[model samples]
Target: MKLNRRTVLSGLAAGSAVLAAPMVMAQGAPRVVVVGGGAGGATAARYIAKDSGGAVNVTLIEPTRQYYTCFFSNLYLGGVRDMDGLGHGYGTLAADYGINVVHDWAVGVDRDAKTVALASGATVPYDRLILSPGIDFKDGAVPGWDVSAQSAMPHAYKGGSQTELLKAQILAMPEGGRFAMVAPPNPYRCPPGPYERVSMVAHTLKEINPTAKILIVDPKANFSKQALFEEGWQKHYGGMIERIGPDFGGENVSVNPSEMTLDIDGVVEQVDVCNVIPAQKAGEIAHAAGITEGDWAPVNAADMSSKMDEAIHVLGDAAAQGDMPKSGFSANSQAKVCANAVLGALTDSRVFPAKFSNTCWSLIAPEDGVKVGASYEATEEKIASTGGFISETGEDEATRAQTYQESVGWYAAITSDMFG
Candidate 1:
């Protein structure tokens, strides 16, 4: 059966409505300072403010007023969506949800003082801190590639202008030219993202330059929805996409922007375009706060509270939650769970058990979409998946088309939930 976003996300939306009851505050409201006003932070801030009524003060700290979602970004690359459609402002989160939206980088986290120091030199004290800062590239994760060369070969993983730049580059590629992608390793954000991107790029090239080629230099042995994506690629974009995995020297990679050269072990190929999506770690603030044990900050599986400090909670890609794939839906689900737990601790309200779900839909072409999803329950150790489903390789055309429609619905609903 095809999974509809409305049906899958009904629990999340309804949970917010039910949990959000106006509260009467006795005195000053407890303050929650949220860093990274993306999926997890925005939802957490909105839910806490709405449900707590005037009883809890919520402040959201984000560097940008407009956040472009990483989810569905590949569609924009494929010319299916536009930049304006991808951009969302925090005005509603501030004006409607009563959250103190601050557009500033959280420079330092003084856990001892229970305060967050802003890049603007202001310190905001908080009863609890919510950290949802997303992924940051690991320094030198890929040889011969860094931030300075991103214009030549964009990751476009973060969306916004990066997505635009990549699209422009793809359009400008010479006829019969080659496009290369340096796919990230295991445990990166959005496990199926690289393959979906390859599909999108192939879609665009087929329309403009059918002779062009798309090369995926993947180190991993396999990827999410591997069979489904492989089938779709063969059916829709036959002879356009070539994925070279570790068995074929995909691991040893280096790039030269000056010469437009990509080196895979002993073999060197010159490509017109390159996308270097290197290794990633939790965002900078997570390490700045000293919450991260290694690449990611460890959190309590039940509440997403930082294992280091009970007063701090980490969510989204930055958090090391068990069995949860790092996706927009997962982050939003974790946010709701974190909000309920945080507010319950502060306001002495009822805290319900955390239930989470995530669905990742990727479009191979027009009306040809594939998806994988799971429902999770908070176990004593991790956010363990109870059951899951993925789009079958031989599913009917109608089902694939319906899945695309479901993704469209999800983008609208999830964005509204985050920024509404």
Candidate 2:
């Protein structure tokens, strides 16, 4: 579907009207504070502000003035996309959507006072708080790997500088040089992201250095879209990429940045460039707020409210919900459900049952894209899938081409839903 200005405005109006009618003007409209302005946080802020119709005061705290999506970063690496295309501004969120966007990092959460303390020494109080700060890497998960070492071996998972670093390394690699990737364990952000990175880098390598090879050292035996990715890699990239799972001693156990080598099962593998995606957990803010246990924050799936604190809700990668991959699309879906639930609680309206949907696209080549998606309904205690995985497997050429186009359409649709 084409997403023009008219369509986006219409969708926003309809979504707001439908969700707002139930909570017209009760208890003076609660002050909703949203942390982070990435996919999940931005979507929640926009929807809540629009639905409240100037009743609820919505404040969104994000450190960055703009956002660069990790979803299409591979395309950027492959030279098919540019920075301008991936970067998004938040002007519409402030002006058209009536959201108060604050550019600051949240340092602490005063749950008792119902306020979020910023590093700037400002404390913003909220009647309800939504936290979606995404993931943080677990230090010491990969020995000898840290922020400083990232200059030599980057993990482009967070986008921005790391992405540019990886790009430069690829361009500088000599013919027949090896590009090694240390894939993360399961339950990380974007299950198909690493594979997509390999594909995109391989595409660039095919042109710049035809003999350059890509080696993926993964701890897990299987990954998302395994067969499809393998097929596409072999068919188009001509066996330039090789994946090493645990069975093949492919686990990225450690790293030695000084020597530019990665230790895989006691064997030191040297490479021209390295990308390490380490194990991750909820952002530091969540942990500091006493909202997370272990690597994730536990929450009530029905409304995404924190199990420990009722007034606070956590969504996106920060929250630990079974059966939902930590993806931008999944986070966006969860944000709407949480927003609706928060509106109902504040206005004393009948809360409608929540349903969620997500679709993740991985491009193996310029013209080839594969995806897996599902639809889910929230249960008494958990969110359960109403439908199973819809694969792009066996799709004909015409169908594949259409799906690729649809993927682009989805990007526009989702970005509009989040910020426009």
Candidate 3:
């Protein structure tokens, strides 16, 4: 019991052991819960699990077992891709990484408790929460249009079965018949998406029914890549696609799904197919979670951490981060930054600076594609674009063809990155 050098060393080692045990357990036991299995949530969940090496528990909450990319569904409609090609499941997320794949709706989020309430009546607690629930339509924004009428006039914005449904309606159009679209307002998911769908529909119609007309009643004066799309439509599907902007009464529009009539600019017309892309807001779960200020959840651009709740990170289309388009690529980029930040908070891991990028390619015709992209860096205020590129308006066929190929490669790569 004498205070010798050996005894003093033994006492110091015991003290160090008692202090280290709690820190080790705390680092290993952190839980991350992701609601929505789309680009942002899926990528974040996978990275947090895979990179952490089983040190953190990850759970993915998604309603659908099979997910389809909204990015390429237009190609599927135009016969450039297939439905099966667009479909991805959570099997890889579970099998390869030990993520808890919960195929249930995230009905509620208790921010105070840092827990998610699923439709199955179970609550999953989390040290960090990631919500990337995408977009939802504003109810009754268009007169005589709502979720109940989605079947009669499909938006096809969410991809999956809706894309298939819209394609079916387009295919069954009468020869020389009219196809009308009520394009969504600005700040919707994929700003160029509606125009791309028009191009794809025209591509299909050119093969089957050359005389068929596609009309777009758009609320916005200008759309993403407006000049490029307009030139392509004229060159490829001449006299087939007519987009009526706000000056032409695109703003004031109403649809009667039952009668198959579209009213634009105080003129009512009967159409063979009516596709209504309504004004949108963040998904309902964001509202349920009380994280949204208006239509979108505000977040710290550097890490995608919610301003309303630091425990939650809002991403993808649900997040209101400036200068980043709400595309799959942007979501995936944000997710990686978020994963690093979350892991750092949980396990004291190294967190890198956030750099994000996105490129959206629209196929005008088979083998002809155009793209717009930008590289962004996290700033104190927002994720600001530093550099960007876009395909030229009059690019040669070979150049356009290469862009299309690049898109195909991107699709394959991103899908693998997200699911696997």
Candidate 4:
């Protein structure tokens, strides 16, 4: 079956049991604890809670009271979206679905004891643990940069404050100033994120500081939707953006956040703003749980179960699942598959076949959006791609506008799917 948004929702509703009344917990119900309340965790928590019909106790551990999405954050940077529009609270999940939404940091995980230790000195025991802690920057991935320099050179990879800081810095740049972005290597969260960010930054600068220039110091030879993004950049922001690839020593780079300088292959240039997107790995709790292989936690393709522990499932950007890019759509898709498996394991629910789909939409200019997506199924080795589609370059204005509209609708649908 085609695993589109509507299909996913309908299939879930048909396969799972009806939603149980709030606070109706069965005696000795199995407890499921989910860490990181972003796309994967929140969706997983909501699905399990709603589907189990109070047959399982669900507790979601997220540090933030208001969860802001990393997706579409670039639109906020570009003034297309507001900051308030990006944040979502878990009140509905708590009051409506009867989930225990704990706003506390999950500092450590004891897989042996099936407990998660929080910063509040509380140990929350779980029969099943779902980790969707998202990506954390790999230390020393970008030379001369660390968390200490975030204020001066914000990564802005994470949502919320860092995004605000980066946009603020952009607005504060001097006229004709240079904005440099150090793109991360492959296997980072959101492959099109940096490019879309460049597009949004260019969009912002063209209005306020028309003479400002943008530089991309990219380590990779090619990037996601390269042809489409390059085409849009030339058509919209010509002569304002320059990219240096590995051939031009873009791979050998360093930054001085204090001085606001970017050094490319021994050539240092003054820059007004530097957005460093470093190589990323699974969040710290995954490592603490000893489930990570190298940088990411490997999971079984059928259920997103961690290779190290069957009781633990790793989802989203943190999991080294094959074929699927690290994206919010992908995470949300994986969450449904995982939720079905977890529901079956815990509550004896009817589990559907594991199918996944992802579509990444990027807004190059106002009402000009392009998308790439694929369908996948579980294989013995991984979640292998089966078929795909992409927005072709040189599409008509009407087509691009329609794509943009589709993206807007998707955002609304997904946020509702996640938060509600």
Clashing pairs in 2: none
Backbone clash pairs in model 2 (N, Cα, C under 3 Å; residues 3+ apart or in different chains), count: 0
TM-score of each: 0.94, 0.92, 0.93, 0.95
Candidate ordering by TM-score (highest first): 4, 1, 3, 2
- Candidate 4 local distance difference test against the native: 0.94
User: Per-residue CA lDDT of candidate 4, range 209-262, in tens?
Assistant: 999999999999999999999999999999999999999999999989889898
lDDT of each: 0.90, 0.85, 0.89, 0.94
lDDT of 4 at 183: 99
Q: Judging by TM-score, tell me the better candidate of 1 and 4.
A: 4
TM-score-wise, the better of 2 and 4 is 4
**Reference-based lDDT, residue 353, model 1:** 94
Query: Which residue pairs show collisions in model 4?
Result: none
Q: How far is candidate 2 from the true structure (C-alpha RMSD, Å)?
A: 5.5
* lDDT for model 3: 0.89
Expressed as tens digits, the lDDT of each residue in 1-420 for candidate 3 is: 789878756764665212222223234578999999999999998888878877888889999999988989999889989999999998878765768899999999988888899899999999999999999999888998998999999988997989999999989999999999999887989888988899999999999999999999988888998888988998999899888989989999999999999888789989999989999999999999998998999999889999889999998999999999989998999999999999999989998899999999989899889999999999888889999988889999999999999999999999888998
* Model 2 residue 116 distance off true place after TM-score fit, in angstroms: 0.6
Model 1 Cα lDDT, one tens digit per residue, 206-305: 9999999999998998889999899999998999999899999998899888888999988999999999999999999999999998899999988999
**Tens digits of per-residue lDDT for model 2, 1-420:** 999988766765776433332223345557899998878999998888776666677889999887988878888899888867888888888766667789999999999989999999999999999999999999887888988899998999986767888999999998799999999997899999999899999999998899999999999999999988888888889879988899977764788887889888888889999998898999888998998878999888888988889999999999987678889999999999998899887766557788888889888888687889898887767777877675556677676677778889998889888887
| Highest-TM-score candidate | 4
Clash count, candidate 3: 0
**lDDT, residue 172, candidate 1:** 95
